[model samples]
Every structure is written in C-alpha cells, then in structure tokens.
Target: MKDRAVLYTFESVHQAIKGEDVLRAAGIACEMIPVPREISLSCGQGLRLAAADAEKSEAAWRQAAVSWQKKVHACRVDGRYRYGVEN
Candidate 1:
C-alpha cells in the first residue's frame, strides 16, 4: 500500500539496536528512526520497515528471541498515515 509504513518500537535505543542486528541477520531491511509521535510521547529509537514487511518482521524478531516494545502500523488516510500500536 502506498504511504504505508511499519515501526517496531523498543524499550530503549539499545534494545532497538539489538533488534536491528537480528533483523539484519535475517536480511530484512530496516532503518533506526526516532519513535513517531503517532506511536509514542517519549523520545526513543524505533526500527522502521516497509508496511509490507511488518508482520514478517515481527515474526522474525520473535523467532530470534529479540524483544520489542510494540509494532505500529500506518496506513494512508487523507493523503497521510497515522500510527497505531499492534501486538
């Protein structure tokens, strides 16, 4: 879906880095970005990925035993997307 994005949140920057490492090992491309305001009120890092990869990405993390805070899925609405948490 166009304009769709997925952000995997962690408890802290360090946890985000650890999750990033495991995802990289699994060959799933992602970026470390600040937690989107749509997702959190506090400053922290998040692993961002294509919306298409959200589910598989979370699965990959779980399979690797990498803990994550939450997954936010964004979908285009009114030419923009809003983030909402997913388990």
Candidate 2:
C-alpha cells in the first residue's frame, strides 16, 4: 500500500474546521490528523491529505481564500520515507 499526507495548521480550531469544510466542498479528500510530533509537540488539530492530491488540494485552498498555514511533506509508508515540496 502507498499513502501520502500533508499537514495544515490554523491559529484556532475554528479556522481548521472551516478550512476542512472548504476543501471538502471542492471535492478534495482530507481528514483531521494529529499534528506531527516532529513539527509541534503541542496538541492541536491539523489536516491530512493524500500525497497524490497535494497539488490540487493546495490549489483549492487558495481558490477558496481559506486562511491557513500549511506544510507539505511527502513520505512513502511502504518503503523509505522522504520529504517533498512545501506548498
């Protein structure tokens, strides 16, 4: 199996939920994932998006004018992990 993930953080939980809604409306598959411990040990909500859809997801967020802070990291779960471009 192969999987990709992206983390999108917001200043507040409200913004995070709102952003999720916008992305869902745009037909982008996303889920609320725990903020990676490496990025921030603090417990907060973030978004997990498929790596294959990363580009389209970012584009949708921009088009929706959703205020968010995002970090795009690509990793291969089945094989060796790696980081990719940040959008």
Q: Highest lDDT among the candidates is held by which one?
A: 1
State which candidate has the highest TM-score: 1
TM-score of each: 0.75, 0.71
The residue ranges of model 1 lying beyond 4 angstroms of the native Cα positions read 75-82, 85-87
TM-score of 2: 0.71
What tens-digit string does per-residue lDDT give for candidate 1 at 34-85? Answer: 8877678889998878787777878887887778988777665677656773
lDDT of 2 at 66: 68
Please give the RMSD of candidate 2 to the true structure.
Answer: 3.4
Q: Clashes in each model (backbone N, CA, C under 3 Å)?
A: 0, 0
